[model samples]
Target: CLGKEVGADIPFCVYQKVARVRGIGDIVEPFKLKVGYDVLLIKPKQGVDTKIAFEILDLDKCPHPDINQVKKALINNEPLKDILGNSLLYSAEKLVPEILDIIKECKERGYEDVVMTGSGSTVFVLLEKGQDCRDLIKFMEGKYPFVYRTSILIK
Candidate 1:
């Protein structure tokens, strides 16, 4: 069970909802953050080992955004770019080359706020309301075998 052993963000991934997961992945506080967006999830051919990725991360160099500020951003419907500006995705990039490539491609395709999700080989791009994400999805599908157009499961 690497849930609590590996990292605190594991359980939050399982729920796929708005939450403030605390206490080393044991405590989950679900909250409502009224926001609307679509996500294009891209999983590249290469696999990234979480253990090795963790080994390479300099914990001191990661950006730790305040939970309250995140909540405020979500509730207030801040631009996706603004909300993800302080994400730790930058630190995790070097360990996952495939994910980084996808991020770069997404940016080139005019997508904003492309981020690697939770020790990932999978990266997601946020599409604001009314944006035509079909072209992005199609492009990713053509490039990668596993691409999903999904939404945040806010409950």
Candidate 2:
């Protein structure tokens, strides 16, 4: 409610299946890119929710950090020198507050474990009841363009 805008990209990108998460080398399954925005990380209908999907990994976001360093580390297939590059990828720093607002909203709605996915527009929220999750998203759709779907954690 702080701002009049909802996640702007959800509508167009929601139903459109984007690219899959890179790496994994075959043991893992391929997933599509259903989201990309500030503060939130959403999983479209085709895959597991990013929250659970990325949970095992030490993932995070940042205000202004060295993305190139992080990418270089990843590209070289070396264990991240700074594993928790929370501030590395910050293409949307101004959106931090927006993300926080969304997280706050999620907390207010009773979700306790909300996490930013890969420093992006997708956000995964841990839910006790899926209906509540659905309802919260439904409410947001009335306010701004958004995507809605249910997915697994690791699939």
Candidate 3:
């Protein structure tokens, strides 16, 4: 909202499903998504500071998932378990080790498409269509304070 009020060209700052940020300062380009997936969001009690995450990030050591491949997977309706990932996962996990635990737990429960969202304690598991998340939700709820079953935005 502030960006709009200031007459800034921040197209992907809000209400965007898939966006590519370039050259910093909210310079983003929105991409069209052909499909959406069922998502299970699990946030632990701890929180990560974005600033610190960036500070601790080592570009050489961090894993960078190919954004183009992710975009192609979404557009072609292909499985993204092997393609989609966040570069900030390494730093974020450093701040909150429980993030790794969450990922491990999700995988142990048969979830393959697990990834950390942004720079933090929340990990999302992409669920296959018609997959029930109740048991997972119940399991996560027993461990964490917030466990939500939701879907990714399509538009």
* Evaluation by TM-score, superior candidate among 1 and 3: 3
Deviating ranges (above 4 Å) for candidate 3 = 1-13, 21-25
Q: Work out how many backbone clashes candidate 1 has.
A: 0
- For model 2 the local lDDT of residue 128 reads 31
lDDT of 2 at 87: 38
lDDT-wise, the better of 1 and 3 is 3
The order by descending TM-score is 3, 1, 2
Give per-residue lDDT, candidate 3, residue 148.
Answer: 87
Per-residue alpha-carbon lDDT of candidate 1 for residues 44-101, written as tens digits (9 for 90 to 100):
8866676777777676877766667767777777765645643445545666567778
- Which runs in model 2 stand beyond 4 Å of their true positions? 1-96, 128-131, 153-155
The sequence of per-residue lDDT tens digits that candidate 2 reaches over residues 31-64 is: 4322222222343223233344344333344244
RMSD versus native structure for model 3: 3.2
TM-score (all chains, Cα) for each model: 0.78, 0.39, 0.84
Tens digits of per-residue lDDT for model 3, 1-155: 47655533444547556666654435666787676678899999999988899999999998899988877887778888888789999999989999999999998988888999767779999886568878888899999998988766777
Q: Highest TM-score among the candidates is held by which one?
A: 3
